[model samples]
Target chain A: MLKDFVKNIGYDDPLEIYLSKLEKLLGSEYGISKRAVSLLLLQEDEEIFELVKKNEGDKIGVISAIIREANSHYSNPLSYIISERRQGEASRITNSVMSVKEKGLFNFKETLSRLMMNPFIGGPILLAVMYYGLYKFVGNFGAGVLVDFIEKRIFDAHINPFMVDLVNRYLPYELLRDLLAGQYGIITLGARYAFAIILPIVATFFFAFAIIEDTGYLPRLAMLIDQLFKKIGLSGRAVIPLVLGLGCSTMATMVTRTLPTKRERIIATLLLSLAIPCSAQMGVILALLQNKPLGLLIWLGVIIGVFLFVGYLASKIMPGELPSFYMEIPPLRLPQLSNILRKTGSRLKWYLFEVLPLFIFASVLIWLGQITGVFGFLVKALEHPVRWIGLPAQSSVAFLFGFFRRDYGAAGLYDLKTAGLLSGNQLVVACVTLTLFLPCVAQLLMNIKERGIGVGIIMSTFILFFSFSVGYFVNLVLILSGINL
Target chain B: MRKIAIVGSPNVGKSVIFNNLTGTYADVSNYPGTTVEVYRGKCKIGGEEFEVIDTPGMYSLLPISEEEKVGRSILLAESPCVILHVVDAKNLARMLMMTLQLLEAGMPVILVLNIFDEAEGLGIDIDLDKLAKELNIPAVKTVGTTGAGMDILRGKIEEHVKRFC
Candidate 1:
């Protein structure tokens, strides 16, 4: 049956010649059919060649002879030859078996897919997606509405006051009670920031992300941005991690492994950690600049400029050949509402579970630090640098919290914003600095786990210095240019 | 016990098929590269038990990335009894290249045309028998998300192992 099938296909003669030589050398010990194995061996299949060489050491001469003979038969490598044959056969079979009726209706989905890939129309669509999906929906609805409800109505009105009073009453030590209830208290501050502020923003971002992802819009976005990415030595595939970075940079760092080259991965990781503001940071920045469109644009411009400049610089510094990018574009489909909801729910649950314990632990640690007066000392130390950046000394705590989590610092900024401690220029500078600051503790640990401790620490240190330096420069530039908001 | 390795390019529903066969939850997503790690489970078929291995996606045998290296290593090391080469039906031309590579590797391959419903919706009509004959292997169409053609796949697996093993 196999021989008959092989004969009908009509590419059996050369394969047969190769197989006969292989079979004669190995005899009964060769378990695989000689023809199939020879094709792989000729293709420089290292694993198969190694096994055959190990088992039939004496027959290496004959096998090499057959490989040379096969090589002489094709100008291209044997792998290409074999693949072409197989593809030809596949297409032949497909043609024989399948018949198409009249062409179906013009698909709007395909047209939309094409439109999304066009640089002209697609650029605006991309901005629209970011503006509405991210700015209007996630920023305003999530951070403004949901966060306000949870942070103010729920935490401040109910949880914080109750926890502060309960702690003050039960704890005998004034210091310990103050640690649990006073400023930077575990329940009153840390837990409230995590659950009430960060959770709502991340949840909304993931929901929006799920919808966009399911609609197959991301790959189209990738295609649209490929030219821009080429300048940075990345391909459309890098877009996956970059987009996800907007949701969570730690996850994006891990996803960088999918990039075809190590250089691409490193560059991608650097950009993600340094420039791409995760959803929490983005939300807070949006809220901070909600009333100042010019400030928001400036903030956006600085981050984007840094992303491109640094990416371009890194690509030049990193020595490697650029990887060619080709991705299969899956047909666009209407995202099923149920699937989007399920994805959002599951991701939210996962995010909450992963973050809640960390937040609680952060609170307890802060409480201990406060009792030991370490928190006060660190805040005092940070105050000078905060003032140097032109931010008020009150911004010191936010910078410290920024080390724990970027979003934590943004939550601190939210508090400061509410208290009216920052002007328009100060808010812009602060946002840019925090956006470029060190990765959160969780991301640091994740980076160490994924990329090693040395690399992670180096990246973090680089980011810390770079962020403040950029902040200082931006402040200088603003003053020098005499741009007043 | 025998072993069956589920292998395919990224996001072709390999994990879903693995979950369907093994009764396990491995995070399924529309995005690729979700299954960065290998997963193993057991299933009973035709009064015999088998070990099922799920691997990361690879576009070709000649690997370019780390994940593909992991996938290719699994194929080389395990020498699975039956290699299930899962391909998206809508992408028959592109995916068949991998199927061809598997067959060339001299592994006992079962070609799984997954996402058949999507192909049908696109008005693609595949002649399964013709394809099977041309490749000299069993070809099965499956809508893995909905458990369609699963029984036929299992039955083919049993039949192949009985005849070949």
Candidate 2:
């Protein structure tokens, strides 16, 4: 057997003494070796510390004394010293067992990786990536082109009509028929939204994301954004969840589990809910504002400003240690085509499974509200704030739809735009408020699940109020200043 | 079933190796830190059926993030027959710390020096026999994405499991 083959890594004398002391004191069988647990305790790993405290009821005082003694002996933090020793051992082993030939030509991949992190070069590259990857491709091609083909040529011409006719013919009772196939019915609106408007946009975004992920540029981009993130009290490590928020805030909210501190997780979740629009919302917003340069610029400015401003305020108000960033940068490589396709396929599979059920549920809920006359009442109530933001009374319908899902609301606005109802300034204001509005039902549930009901409810309430106030303020400033786009 | 759990730092091809051994996909990508959850599948290697778990990436035994906790829980609970500590061969030094930790924990660990193609391209030649003897554990070189040396890795796992478990 290999039982006696365990490598014995000797730590410095003082730490080693504590490790032995802790190992002797440990009576309850931890699943791992007591040696590993003892090392973890020396590193001040909080969970292990608590576990040891729980397991060793009376021996804690001696363990604390030993830890303090070890701490006093080290000039640096114990973790730093321990990690350095481990690294030294690792490199020593590597040197003994590996040989290298001088293949020291310039690694173009390495150089390109640096160029991506360099501020002057990275800034333009980021813009080009955003403009092409997000705006032009997802906006023009997915939302504009593919959505028209699916929504108009396919759904409008065939599926919706067939469903409506089938409902009319089969169901004698009007209410039952309307619930499944009427104006806001599950078949008519929910399925259409999922397949026609949202699918094309989401698939395109995932395709772009897969390629970006394959190239290993995210961590380098993280390095570039680290400074700005520092100002917002987040380390560059928050970049992963925050950037993933662009794809889907619901998933990103869950991804915030990777954040180190509770403060960072809450702050990241708040920012994701308030500032980051999910892919469908992003695609629709791009399709709406891409042609209108001034309006699109204003929209961009508003969202970024809100993201930074709110993050800063939240960090200042909530007390925690400022975040520290440390992440390994994977080297850049040309993305493998097969890997890209497989990753995209898997992610797309996940996105559809998560979002589709929610879309259908939203439609059924809307139908219930409409038949019960609550939808009319809610939209009527929302119209006051809608008009206050310089939007027409009809815009309240879109705003109400936003409470269910952001992209659905944005799609409603897209319909309004095609009807030539909203002016440019009004369009900007509507976009700003909708982008900042409450998280979709799925995200709200995720927030509740992760952060608990009290925090989730409080967060959504604060977001609802702040988004409108900003919309009102932006509209007022633009109107009073006579800025025309 | 006797289990073989694959673990390493993020983006080091744990999922790829898992796929090669299990014939199932676990969402491989070039970016670091994408595997946020655990994935499991079944594999038949060396005439033995083993349950294989692909865990979320972890840096060290002292877990700082939730994903690391998820990865560590399986190690402490399931007590896998062989811990395949997959490391990117190019960054072998940086990754060896976790392998060292796993070994010190008295777990049965087989070092998977993965991405050998990239290491070879960088002119780094690893003497697998020497490395294995130095570390006092079995080591295999693999390019997980392409299944290079996967059979050797599997054979090593079955050998370790049969010997220890």
- Winner by lDDT: 2
- The CA lDDT of each predicted structure is 0.82, 0.88
* Residue range A1-485, candidate 2, lDDT tens digits: 22455687898777888789888988886778888888887888888778789988989888888778878888998889888988999999999988999987988888889899998999999999998998888989998899999999999999999988999998999988877788778888778878898889999998898788778888888899999999998988888889889998998898888888999989999999999999999988887886788898888899999999999999999978988788889878778888878877877888779778877788777778887889889989999989888899998988888988899899889889989998889889999999999989889999999999998999999999999999999999899999986
Per-model TM values vs. the true structure: 0.88, 0.95
lDDT of 2 by residue, B33-94 (tens): 77888899999987889999999899998888888999998988888888899999998788
**Model 2 per-residue lDDT at A298:** 89
Which 10 successive residues of model 1 chain B have the least lDDT summed?
A: B24-33
TM-scores for chain B, listed for all candidates: 0.98, 0.97
Chain A TM-scores of each predicted structure, in the order given, are 0.90, 0.94
**Candidate 1 structure quality by residue, lDDT tens digits, B18-72:** 9889886665666677677788999988988999999988988777777777887
Task: Please report the candidate that would top TM-score against the real structure.
Answer: 2
